[model samples]
Target: MSTPMWKRVIARILEALLAIVFLAPLVWVIICSFSPQAGSAQSDGWGINNYLTLFNYQAGLPTYLFNSIVVSLIAVVFSVVVCTLAGYSFSRFEYPGRNLGFMVTLSILMVPYASLLIPMMVWFKDIGLNDTLLGVGLVITLFQLPMSTFIMRNAFNAVPKDMEEAAMVDGCNSFQALVKILMPVVKPSMVTVGLLAFLEAWNNFMIPLYLSSSAKSTLPLAMVNMRQQTMGVIDYGATEAGVVILLIPCAILFLVLQKYYVKGFMAGAVKG
Candidate 1:
């Protein structure tokens, strides 16, 4: 089956094209960020001044970064806890409405975030949960829960039932079997779900816009205001620096859990 030179070449070409298409925006952002401000003779020149300003707190970046990190982390933790329990229940327990319940979870996944905005705000306001980090975190957790649950459910299903039976025979209770054995085996899936949830919360703008107070504006909202303020200026160095800051946590998270994510993806693909 090694007679596919033309096909291999074509595949490589297509991959390269896709990579360029995906990377063009990031490359442009980096270039624009390093470019000199208008009226400067040195156009397209690179400098670290943008990063310097970011660290210097001229743009309230520190507060934004802190707010984003706090909310994203909290959201991830809450989502993981809720989803792991629910997924385990759905996977192992034969209960009434199990299939119907999964269908409902799938239905939630189909609904776009935009459709829930107004109703979520109204509920948040009624409960006095508005304009707070906890409120934003809870909203992010709620939005991400169904997807994470679905992922974890499939992960749990992929585990061998024989192992659970053995654990039960060895005097292990249901909780002990899950925590001591199954949880360790499915660590990769948990990591994948957690990282994805964190990214979603970190990049969230609409929720933070409506739910976060001015003093607790997340990085995305801060970036929006920065863009508006610098509209006439040719220099986008600071803006790019902000984006770099916004991307750091996500980049680090993905790099650390890339192996797990790949494994989870493959496992889910197989199940599907």
Candidate 2:
């Protein structure tokens, strides 16, 4: 290993090259988002005019952003809560049809996602949940459940049963032990589930397309609508601006939670 200076240097060079290749498109988008374009509202000069145009489009950036945030938060909370309980049950308890039930939940993943949305749209409409942000969030949560449950169940299984038994011996009820002890131990998995749920709900287009209205559109849907111009011309400047806006939060979230997210997956993989 000490004699491998040349190999290390070559590896560094390759990594730099790969980074550049990956970053080039993102850099281009950021630059293009600020550059003035023909027929753009801010064609006067290079600036944030494209961003201003995006801000003013449709019901405005704030409305779409709020819609996206609300839906994503709902999905994150619902996914974490439901998956945590389901995973714990599947891993710790023996109930009739338990294996069959878990199998059914996982089987949902085998179905086509797009096909599921159409029939769900009809059901949601019948329940008066159609055309609402809550409906879209529920759909996102449903899709996240299978994978989230699997991750959580494995995470719970990775922990020693003796810890739970010890807590019970100390007079803590099962629910109390889970809440005060096991939940903290599994925090990383919960974070992983929440983050995945948030990202899916934030960027999901199909669910919103079928379940939400124009007024309740999320940022991705808003971006698609904003890209169209009169006479079929695409507004590249504002579109790039929208792309940058959409990318920023996701990038920041992943960077911030990278440590926990990796740990969560590793914890789950340990037992299964």
Candidate 3:
């Protein structure tokens, strides 16, 4: 069932073209970020000045970047732990309404975040969680849970039941078996869930904007602030530089976790 040589060549050609098509804009952006203007490599003797200007601007980026990292980490950790545990339960334990429960878990994705914003805002405000990174992180964790849980459940379900039985036969408790035996088998799903959760939390603007005030913000909110401040002035060069800075972490994380990310998603899909 191998492909014909001609088809293989066509696929290689298409892949090369598609790669260029997708990467060209990113390359252009990177080039522009280093340049004071388009089609120039900061010819006016530029070198990371644009980057410095962005971070050093009034109400500078350090605090906001800290906020983003803190929130994203908290959210990612909580989301991954809760969802993975939930997924294990869903995949391994059968009980009444299990199917219905799984559907309900996934139903959140259909519920628009905007629709919940007002209610969530009011609730958080009343609970004294508003205008805080903790609140934002918790809200992010809530949104991330459904898909994370689904991915994890599928990952666990895909693992052979005999493995768990074998581990138990070796006198290991359920928890020990899960941790020592099953976890390694599903490590890819865990990485995928963590990466997705982190990216979502890091890139989120609306949640932070709504839940946080002027005194506090995440990177995404700070980016918006930068846009507004630079709007009339319109310094595309600095803005693009800031964007490149912002993109670095995401790109790095994806590159590191890509192999696992694909495997995790595919494992879930195959199981489903």
Q: Candidate 2's residue-wise lDDT over 1-272, tens digit each? A: 38599999999999999999999999999988988788676577889988998999979999999999999999999999999999999999998999999999999899889998889899988999999888888889999999999999999999899999999999999888889889999999999999999999988888898888889999999999888898888889999999999899999999999998998899857575
Best by lDDT: 2
TM-score of each: 0.88, 0.95, 0.91
Over 106-209, each residue of candidate 3 has an lDDT whose tens digit, in order, gives 99999998789879999998999999889999999999988899899989989999999999999998888889998999999999999999989988988988
Candidate 1 — which pairs collide? none
On a 0 to 100 scale, what is the lDDT of residue 215 in model 1? 84
Instruction: Single out the weakest 10-residue window by summed lDDT for candidate 2.
Output: 36-45
What's the CA error at residue 78 for candidate 2, in Å? Answer: 0.3
Global CA lDDT computed for model 1: 0.80
* Model 3 segments more than 4 A misplaced: 37-45
Q: Candidate 3: which pairs clash?
A: none
**Local accuracy of candidate 1 as per-residue lDDT tens digits, 1-272:** 58599999999999999999998987777776667765322244667777666555434667888889899889989987888888888999998999898889778877887788778888888998888888899989888878788888988988888998899999998889999888888788788788888999899999898777668888888766655343365335666777877777787888888999988655555663
In candidate 1, clashing pairs total 0
Supply candidate 2's per-residue lDDT for 112: 80
- Which residue segments of model 2 deviate by more than 4 Å? 1-3
